[model samples]
Target: MAPISIRNNPDRLRYEVLDGDLAIGQAAYVDDGEGRRIFYHTVIDEDYGGQGLAGRLAAQALDETVAAGLMIVPVCPYIKNYLGKHTQYADNIQKPTPALLTVLNNALARRTRR
Candidate 1:
């Protein structure tokens, strides 16, 4: 089995999960520019399914976001559901707001334009 690693790729506004040197999954988010990371989506390649990579990715991303003194805004259903079962991040979670959704939407639109 290949080793797994997770990293924040701020340039791309996402956290990438790697199997050795290959990217196998990603959790996408946008910084609200106000101490919040609005997570919008997460996915693992079908080939790598059933390995718990999504959980690992969520844990690492949420951990790092808290460590950085940022709040988590889980717009993605997976992330929201993960938080429902994990209380550690309860204090750091911010419910999604319309303004935050705008932030995420604008960021995604900009990315698509590029």
Candidate 2:
């Protein structure tokens, strides 16, 4: 299998698959006063679902966020679950707040659009 490529699109706050030419996963975030607060809403296309693409994307996103020194707010159910299983990323997780939830919801809406 070809290696997966994750590219961060700052304009859309999403990390996409460059090799597959497919948007295998994405995360949403908002610029808070301190830093970017990421909320992952990742989805692997059905054809790619079982291949560990989502995890890879999420891991890359977390890695990038850490590199940038940004905190995260994992509002996406998948992300929440994934993080629950991956304690190593806990330090990067930001505590969720009402405002952050609003931001996450809005970002998700934008992502659903064409």
Candidate 3:
């Protein structure tokens, strides 16, 4: 397997992972001055799914956000659940509004059902 590489594609508004020559996963976000309010998605190629690549991608994205002095709005369910399990990241979390939480939940549900 090729080592995981996390890259920031400002034009795409997200961080992505390249596993060897393959694009294994991505964490999309939106940047507002207050912080990088992350949302929408993460998808690991089926071949890479069981290797914890998604978590690694999330960790890298979080690290980048912190390095940039930005907080996180984990509008993406993977991120919310990650923060839930990894309380250490709570410091960077920007509290979510109910509507936002609803949207995240819905996205998660949709993804899960697929």
lDDT of each: 0.94, 0.74, 0.75
The candidate maximizing lDDT is: 1
Best by TM-score: 1
Worst 10-residue lDDT window, candidate 1:
96-105
What is candidate 3's CA lDDT for residue 80?
84
| Candidate 3 lDDT tens digits, 34-101 | 45465567777787678887888888888888888887887678888887888887787887777666
lDDT of 3 at 55: 88
Pick by TM-score: 2 or 3, better one: 2
Give the higher-lDDT candidate: 1 or 3.
1
- The true-versus-predicted C-alpha distance at residue 10 of model 3, in Å, is 1.7
Candidate 1 collision pairs = none
How many clashing pairs per prediction, in order? 0, 0, 0
Residue runs of model 2 more than 4 Å from their true location after superposition? 1-3, 105-114
The CA lDDT at 32 in model 3 is 52
